[model samples]
Target: MVRPKEFDERVALTAAMQVFWEKGYEATSIGDLTERMQIARPSLYATFGGKKELFETALRAYVELSLTYVENKLRSMPSVKASFLAYFQGVIEGSGGSNPDFGCLCVNTMVELAPHEPVFAQITEEFEARLTELFRKSIEGGIQSGELPDQLNPSSIARVLTLTAIGLTVTMKMKPSPSRVEHVAAEILTLLE
Candidate 1:
């Protein structure tokens, strides 16, 4: 009979995610995960299958954490445009300081492994689709509230904004200057107004 796991999965996953986020999937070793997770190798394998499986868990955790922020912006902000601006501002502000090497995990995975890994490609696509949907919904809300121009196409504009955000995220890895990043974000936000 299998025994119930004693360790906190969420805590372990958070540590694992941090390790994977700091180091790309290709570069993260099993030793790294085990060391970061503070678990035995046998226990890690038993609970999470293998390095790939653990990395997938970490990816899911990252998405969950990100979505929490997105959901908060969507539900609580006074206006759709304001919520989106806040969201992008958060992204710009968050991608700074000591960990500039690690950009958005989803974007990093797309650049590093999506071309060769079908599973990672699908995961990345899902993340992009969800982000697009969030922007599309915000655009639709803006139209309904008469905040955006009537003729504007929410779907296309959302795609553009999403792509622009992704570009900014990837670019942050190369250029950590807050002013430059904010400038690019300002241009993107101009489309909304």
Candidate 2:
């Protein structure tokens, strides 16, 4: 007897994610989400519960989506070193549109809420850990395949890469450009090489 809802949930969620990315969790109002998502409050509540819940979903989605993007780039290149080079180059290139100034949502959230909120700290920590793990795996792969020197410590290198990414994301928000992002990425790759 009940009719199904009509709006595209994924699109709305992605929009909400963008809004949250631009404005931190605490600063984003219901009106902001409704406006950005093109949905009424009732529908938003029915689909995503509330602002907190929606923000959590957005954060998780951002992490998953970003990880997938990085993974694909790292896996597709001819060499592991090249994979990372392209990946970081892409970061500096920005999204190639408006909102280039919006940095990593997870990092922004960490800066805004992690100090006061344990939940955010956990999310931010997980985000960093995942990046570190991804870098570690890629470096390990390079070592196994003879693309990199065996004596190099993958863990330390990965930590450094992760830190570089964090720093790049932060810097991009202030002034995002291909030259800047590439410069940092290239310098970081120097360690890998």
Q: Which candidate number has the best TM-score?
A: 1
Summing lDDT over every window of 10 consecutive residues in candidate 1, give the lowest-scoring window. Answer: 92-101
Across 1-193, the per-residue lDDT of candidate 1 in tens digits comes to 9888878988898889888889889899989988989988998998899998888878877876676667677666887767777777766766322244577888888899889989889888998889888889888888998988888888999899878878877877786666677665556778886
The Cα error of candidate 1 at residue 22, in Å, is 0.8
TM-score of 2: 0.90
Best by lDDT: 2
> How many residue pairs clash per model?
0, 0
Cα-based lDDT for every prediction: 0.80, 0.84
Q: Which residue runs does candidate 2 get wrong by more than 4 Å?
A: 1-3, 95-100, 176-182
